[model samples]
Target: MKKAALLSIAMLGLTACSQGVQTMTDRTASPCGDKPNCVSTQDNREKYQLAPFTLTANASLDNIEEVALKLPGAKTAVKEGGYLRIECTSRIMRFVDDLELKIDGRTLVVRSESRVGYSDFGVNRKRADQLREQLKQSGLIE
Candidate 1:
């Protein structure tokens, strides 16, 4: 019985570790690995590449930050200059995904990456799409 309990606890620990977030480097998010767990607008690698969106005349850094903060699982966000970093946590297991956005003139570059795991089941991509839709709906992006 004790061994079974220990095994269960160990399994839970491993599960949590599997979804842990890694340290983000600099203002730009880290590059995506060979895994499919990350998506980024700045990436040139075809498998990890995503198209950036253009900001509208009404858009500003504050509006962009607001849209990201309104995300369902958004836990924390920080903005500096033209860069915004948001941390979104999963509902159940509480896994974290780091999303970084940088505005250059009218273009918004985005990057979303899982801290752990080799795959996010496309959640990262879906989240970026949702953000884009929100920005468009709010007239922040064109």
Candidate 2:
């Protein structure tokens, strides 16, 4: 009877240990590997390349106030001699006309011109082919 009981306990322990094994979830670290705390716990960006933008600047107090009032999510981080720093973001990165639009506080403002038509300029160009080969190897610009 004791041998049977021991055998049953061993089997039960094995079953419990198997059930306790953890499975890895579908997730990855930051796709760009820049934002250390990014929640992109999986390699999700199979198509879109990761993009990031950051800037620091100094401007007059009056200009800082004006910028703050005009842009959504735009904030001054440093101030000295009537000047301040501006850090900003927006919900959308829109390329329009000659400028890109970014949010300041609750509005869009001109930022930069959108780049386009690389193939039009690159396809027959050796430099273009080189870039294409590089991107293909990097698993980008397919």
lDDT of each: 0.83, 0.30
Candidate 2 lDDT (Cα, 0 to 1): 0.30
Q: Could you estimate the TM-score for every candidate?
A: 0.80, 0.21
Candidate 2 per-residue lDDT over residues 98-139, each given as its tens digit: 112232332222121112222222111222233234433433
Q: Please list the residue runs of candidate 2 whose C-alpha ends up more than 4 Å from where it truly belongs after superposition.
A: 1-60, 92-142
Q: What is the number of backbone collisions in each predicted candidate, taken in the order shown?
A: 0, 12
Tens-place lDDT digits, model 1, residues 54-75: 9898888888888888886885
Tell me how far the alpha carbon of residue 41 in candidate 1 is from the true structure, in angstroms, after superposition. Answer: 1.0
Which residue pairs of candidate 1 clash? none
lDDT assessment of candidate 1: 0.83
- State which candidate has the highest TM-score: 1
The count of residue-pair clashes in candidate 2 stands at: 12
